[model samples]
Target: MSFSLFRASVRRAATAPRAQLRSQLRIPLRKFSTPPPEAPVPTPKSNTTLYVGIGAVVAAAGVAFYSFSDSGSNAVKTGVQAAKVKANFVPTKEDYQKVYSRIAGIFDDAGDYDDGSYAPIILRLAWHSSGTYDKESKTGGSNYATMRFAPESQHGANAGLNVARDLMENIKKEFSWISYGDLWTLGGVAAVQEMNGPKIPWRPGRVDGVQTQATPDGRLPDASQGSDHLRKIFGRMGFNDQEIVALSGGHAVGRCHSNRSGFDGPWTFSPTTMTNDFFKLLFDEKWVWKKWNGPKQLEDKGTQSLMMLPTDYVLVQDKIFKKHARAYADDEALFFKDFAASCAKLFELGVPTEQWVSPEPWIMKNVDEK
Candidate 1:
């Protein structure tokens, strides 16, 4: 055969075999004895997707923080000012008159308490409680209501005060919000005003006390005692001679009962009304030593109705104190104004200066009027 023809013939043989193999493989065949090796399973890709997701979250947080910082400066918060005074805690003149009106209702008729009695004793209770205040340690003031306790209630000066406290319980129920200290003091003010005394400037904030808070015994004055003893006792409470005389003006309302103070009778003719009479009687009335079986007390020589305690005699005899007493007797307005101011100061003796919201006076209303 020719060389070109032979080469072409060899190529045809090889190509012919490839085509035949392709055609034979195209026919479907089930392997009975042996299965073809399974295609190699692809290995799992490393967890790149999870890491990408975490990165996106971190980027979002970073963006948020930057946004807050880039915002305008935060507004400065205003702070409260120190040494700032709020407002006055004191009530007005109308408040006092209101309280007086209520007390009047309690005794509208002439015969109110045991045929027009008991009011004077109630006034005495208030005076004794507040009168115990000492400015030195700021203790024993109306702030504590300590009289509700034992030693204080049993005090000789405070005798028969329970009657006043018990009587006040009804008024307390009517004015539940008022503190015992406020109620008692305000009661005195109201009693005096209702009885025709000067207006007393008052403030509330006296706390009520439990039975254990009563004051020590012998804190009060004895009616039989002289000027020296009176000064010592009242002085312990931080009272001046002027304050002593002014506070004694409280006697204008109440009387000495034979059963109570052991010396019997009222200081003034008009016991219910507040007056200069206490001073007037001290100077004008001829006080004679009483001829009595009980205790040594003075009786008015003229009427024989008015009474004088040993302490009362000191007013006329003591030069320093007598000045204030005499001045009060001479001038009605001066006594009224001085008495009102001093009484207000006496009631607030132990209260801290800082705690006082207002230094001004609070005129309380009559419970009945409210």
Candidate 2:
């Protein structure tokens, strides 16, 4: 008989009801065995047939034991165990969208937080986690999500990020299967989209790494530094002048905390919404040094309520950076397009192309769309 037919027979016998199996077992063991008087000398073809028959018999016997040896419940339990082994959980885009929805729901839950929204800090967490990338050494970046460990988490640039981390921990508990790198970056994407920013195309594949993989300190930018420092830092991550200017537009939403960065105040009037107002205010008004005991930062002369970091001020001071900044200030649509592209690149740093689940990034819909 063909092997396929033999296997099909075995499957039918294994799945038979317990009473049927008992009756079949009683039919006769001698019927399946070769008669001693008529048995031929062993040959390759005969041996192969004998082995296949033996295997089928053994398989059917094991299945019968599991199915009827104890109770009907045992048979169901065995089937479940086999099914579990055959089905492994793989998250799809819809699963990721559910995660995105959860994050967006919690953005404004904290009444005491800056601007009454967790969106800024969540975006910062994604930024700092990814900003650690070193193109030459391939040491840092979002691939590992190493900020959960020490040294990197304790880095000066990461101060007050614990709030962001703690906030994400809650989300992690709810979606236990997601890696930290994917979760944090997804949080950033959700924050941007919910705040009316550009639709950042995203995909999932990043895996969690150990403490030994944590990047060294100073990989992130220093807010006190100027244009040269900006170039050296972002350049290390393989970003150009235009990309740097485009990324700086992120300052439009978040404010500095005295307890965190030492320099205090929001970069724009609306510290919660996404807008090109940061660029507009950068050139539209004069910036003067804020007279404070804190670290040196610039304040708008018009209202003095808004603030800009030394790194931010350098964009207008440096000619190349100024050219791009001028363009963004003139065109909000262009700023959104560039920001989405560059930020998507930043979030995907250190992740291998093969690890991505999708050929193209997914543009997750905003919560309002749902």
Candidate 3:
């Protein structure tokens, strides 16, 4: 069985920036539902959200239009000028590749990061940044890199993600035309592929978020919950059982920090690399409730070193979730295919399909792939 890995060839020439398309079409969702008529007092902890500065030019149409509210009442909004943003120059695929290299290069260069690489945190930034989408209200998701501001920044689920954001911000300085939504998600794809994970199809068009556009906290999954909660949370984003398990494969990479999530330990031995190991170990190992002062979590009875959250444990306990979990453990190839498709959907949660510039999202070549 082959791992399907690729190393970068000498950098290749990228296509020129394409023409910008201006649409008179009004976005279906009313930008942001005008803040409720009886809005509460704007406290420091109230509606304010975040926007990390990343300039994005449309790769397809070439326009710099960001979806969501044009008004300041939005919970999470982009700071980019709503009017057409002129780039110092039009961005080409080469521009994006430079960004991919930079994201890949950070892992080798960062001396102060986890697992000797920035892969894990970068995935979290992509997940947390995009996980906020609520299909019901048509709010949240990666469209606006809303986690940069308040309330959302200090949210429990987003704890420690500032590290990932700070890292991405450094890249934003170099590529001013890429949106934070696109850049961070691309960083996620880079981290996964470089770490030997699947190739996730990523597209650009995310606008930067504004302070007022921030979504309320508590939207992310809580490790303390069970299968019902899993459905409730991911379900809100419109994810089903199969997609939920596939996304959880991400835990194959990155350990929980005692200081950050309060839960501790790696789910798989190779936390910096992606593998079916998360599922393999989930079935192969004997897990027992971790005896700890921190919080109620699971420890592998085989070796007390590895950990699983109450949430992860439920995947096997529940009948429906267990079925999918076992399928992944049995077949790495199946897991990879499903994980790629689910993740591609995960990143595009709140984005309107029509807004995407490319009819087929681009599969960016990995640093290893020529």
Candidate 4:
């Protein structure tokens, strides 16, 4: 009744239920080993529930997206609209002519400015704003109205440019369609032309860019720099020997302020006039090192009132620059032509070829001429 019966019971359990238990384990293994049965292909009759379930998921996703994205969506839409408004605006040449004449009317009434005119400083605004261009990176320049950003405005080179910019702001209010780049540059042109200088062929269509697009400081030529540095800075702008000589003629107008440029005094006797006088002075005068508590600069030996940047002195020291400088000095007409071309080039720097307001620049008639 003990061992024999126990053995018989074990054999019965193994043969009968044990095989079934093994079969059950194998069934699970085989089920996993093979692919589970294909999901039943949705039948037309069954698709209603399936479609309803899918539609519910999609609708929920749509609601979630709309709720979360509302602010961002509105921002994008507003930005696009603002861009469109800017794009559609096309100020006529006549409208610009009005701006050109109006800017000519703004002179130094306060007697607080240099040369008894805001014209010189106004010209410098165009100069500094457009001067930031790098033909390589195509950054800087007036295209961004970049001086409006503090980073460019704070640069020592651009120190007093706010006076120029603020003067133009009055004009900006009247002609809202005009970009600051165009206004400032046009002001430069008008200053030259109205001051009895050459006709600066001008155009518009510089779009305002943001602060991220602002060029880093020191791109403008340091008055402290020599010929080699001038070559590196201006050459980067694609200016040639003749162009550099011509551009220096802008010194004919503006004065260097100790508070602004850290160098004080006018370049020529007539700081109000843009002329070959700068070239004449560059060649004909004696420039002695200025002895001052301020930054190092050169004073005209005969008259300590005038100043010359080292970069300016380089024009004569470098033979290539001297030739053009002498040529511009010899012929006032030639100086006017080259200076006009250089001003046009400087204003156009960093502007994409396609972005110009005109295919060929306009020779805006001076108020007297008009």
Q: Rate the local accuracy (lDDT) of all candidates.
A: 0.56, 0.71, 0.67, 0.66
Number of the predicted model whose lDDT against the real structure is largest: 2
Error of 3 at 218 (Å): 0.9
Model 2 C-alpha lDDT per residue in residues 1-370, reported as the tens digit of each score: 0000000001111133323533544521110111112222233222333333323332343355355433354344334433322233344566677788878888767565565567878888888889889999987888768898787888878887788899888877676656678899999898787767999999876756656678988778887888888889899999999999998888877677776667676776565668898899999989999999998888988778767788888889999999999999999999999999999999999987655666678899887674
Clash list (residue pairs), candidate 4: none
Model 4, span 1-370: residue lDDT tens = 0000000001111112323533543421110011222322233232233333333332343344334433454233324424433343234566677788778777534253444567777777788787778877767777657777667778877776677778888877666545667888999898888666899888765765555567888777777777888777788888888888888887776667666666666676655556788889988898999998987778887757677777788899998989999999999999999889988989888876656645678889777663
Better of 1 and 4 by lDDT: 4
- The estimated TM-scores of all candidates read 0.68, 0.77, 0.78, 0.76
**Candidate 1, 35: how far from true, in Å?**
99
Work out candidate 2's RMSD over C-alphas: 23.7
Q: Is candidate 1 or candidate 4 better by TM-score?
A: 4
Best TM-score among the predictions, by candidate number: 3
lDDT of 3 by residue, 197-250 (tens): 888998765766555668998788888878888898889999999899988888
Reference-based TM-score, model 2: 0.77
Ranking by TM-score: 3, 2, 4, 1
Q: Candidate 2 — what's its lDDT?
A: 0.71
